[model samples]
Target: MLGSSDPQNARPASLDAIDLSMLAELERNGRLTNAALAARVGIAESTCTQRLRSLRDRGVIRGFRADIDPAALGLTLQALITVRLGTHGREQIRGFEQRVRSLPSVLTAFHVAGADDYLLHVAVESAAALRELVLEHLTTHPHVRHVETQLVFEVLEGSGMVPREPVHPPHV
Candidate 1:
C-alpha cells in the first residue's frame, strides 16, 4: 500500500555506505531486530535506529509487509487479467480503480500504457473462482471493453531495488 504524499519524500536524501548496507540486509530480511540489524550492518544500535527512521521519513523504504503465499490460504490459482477500457474518461478510470481496490483477491493492479488500460494480478481458489472474478468484477463493468486472462505457472522474486551506483564499499 502506497502512502499519501509526504513533502519530505519529494526531495532526495544522500545515503552513505552504512545506509546502503542496512537497506540491502533489510531487503533480504525485514524481520531483523534492531540489535541484529545494527550488528549485520556494522553500526551501533542507536545509529541504526536513526538510519531506519530517516529511510522511512524520506520514503526510501515503504512499510514492510508479510510475503504471504496464496496457496497457504487456499487461494491456489493465480492469473494476470488485462482489462481494456471502452473510454478514457477521468471518472471512468477513477471508478474502475476504485472498483479494483475493493476486490479481496487482487494482489496488484497496474494502470498500464498500451491496448489494455489495467493489468491485475489475482489469486483464487480454483478455475471457477477465477472465472467468477473476471466475469462478475471485471468484464461486466460498464466501462470495460475487453478482458483477457492468463494463468500463472510460477513466480520468481528479484533482488529488490538495490542501487547500482556507488556500490556498498568494503569496510575499513
Candidate 2:
C-alpha cells in the first residue's frame, strides 16, 4: 500500500530496474500473487503492490488474460486471410472490421498498410469451415474485392514486448 506522502506515487519519467524486473516477471506469469511476486523480485509485498498499481495507472500494464490453447478448444486449424477491400473509405473500413470481428472463427483482425487492406488470423475446426468462411462470408461481402488465405503450419506466440531503446553490443 502506497501512503499519501510516498514518493513513488509521483509518475516516473522512465521505469527503474525494479519496474523492469516486475514487468519481466509479470510477462512470464500474469497470475502471480503479490506475496509470491514480492519474494521473486526480492521486494516487500506492499512496495510490489504499489509498483503494480503505478504500472497499471500509467497504462504500462495494459491488461491480464488467460493463455488459452485454441487447439484444446477444437480450433486446431489456423490461417492468415489477406483481404483486399473494394474501397478504403472510413465507412467501408469500419463496416468490414465490424463484420469480420463478428465471425467466431476470426481470432484477430488487423487493418494493415501493405498489398492487402486487412489481415485476419482465423482458427477453425476443418477445411470445410474455412472454405465456408472464405466463400460465403468474406468473398460474398460487397466491400471485399479479393481474399487470399495461407494455411499456418505452426504458430509461435510470444509475450508481445517491444524494447524502448536500441541495444548495442557489450564491450569486451
Candidate 3:
C-alpha cells in the first residue's frame, strides 16, 4: 500500500542495457518465444533464458496475462468506484484489503492516497450488477464509510508500456 505496485521481498538486482532491452521486448510481447527474444535482444538463447530467470527471481517480471475485454465476455459495463473507510486501524485496513480481494467483479483495486482510500476498477454485466457489487462487497463492510462510482466509456490498452531506463523496484 505504500506504493502503486511494489516489488515482492526479493534480492536487489541491477539491469544492464541488454536486460532493459529484453524487458522492453517482453513488455511489447510477453508470448514471444525464447529464440525470438534472444534474437531481438541480440543475445544467445541460453543467456536469454538465464536473464529471464534472473528477472523473475528478482521480481522484475511479475506475470504474463491476457488482456480480456469485458464487452467480449458479456460484461459490458465498467466502473471506477472510489471508497473511503471510516476507520484506519491496522486490523480494519487488513480486513478491508482481504475482503476486496475476494470479489470477482473487481478487475483491479488500488489502496491509494488522496481523498479516497481505494479505487476499484470493476466490470459487470449491467448497472444492476454494479449496484449489487457495491452493496454486497463494498459499502456493506463495517469500515467503509463512503462509496462513489463512475462509469467507464472506454479503456485503451497500454499494458506493454515501460520506461527505457531500468528503474529499481522498491523492496516490499
Runs in model 2 deviating more than 4 A are 1-13, 159-168
Q: Pick the candidate with the highest lDDT.
A: 1
Ranked candidates (TM-score, high to low): 1, 3, 2
When 2 and 3 are scored with TM-score, the better candidate is 3
120 Cα displacement, candidate 3 (Å): 0.5
lDDT of 1 by residue, 25-137 (tens): 88889899999999997889999999999888776788899999999999999999999999989999999999999999999999888889899999999999999999998
- What is the C-alpha lDDT profile of model 3 across 62-129, one tens digit per residue? 78998788889999999999999999999999999999899989999998999999999999999999
Per-candidate TM equals 0.87, 0.84, 0.85
Per-candidate Cα lDDT values, in order, are 0.89, 0.86, 0.88
Clashing residue pairs for model 3: none
lDDT of 2 by residue, 28-142 (tens): 8899999999998899999999999987877678689997778999999999999999998899988888889799999988878888998999999999999999999999888
| Candidate 1, superposed: residue stretches over 4 Å from native | 1-13, 163-172
Ranking by lDDT: 1, 3, 2
Clashing pairs in 1: none
For model 3, give the 10-residue run with minimal summed lDDT.
1-10
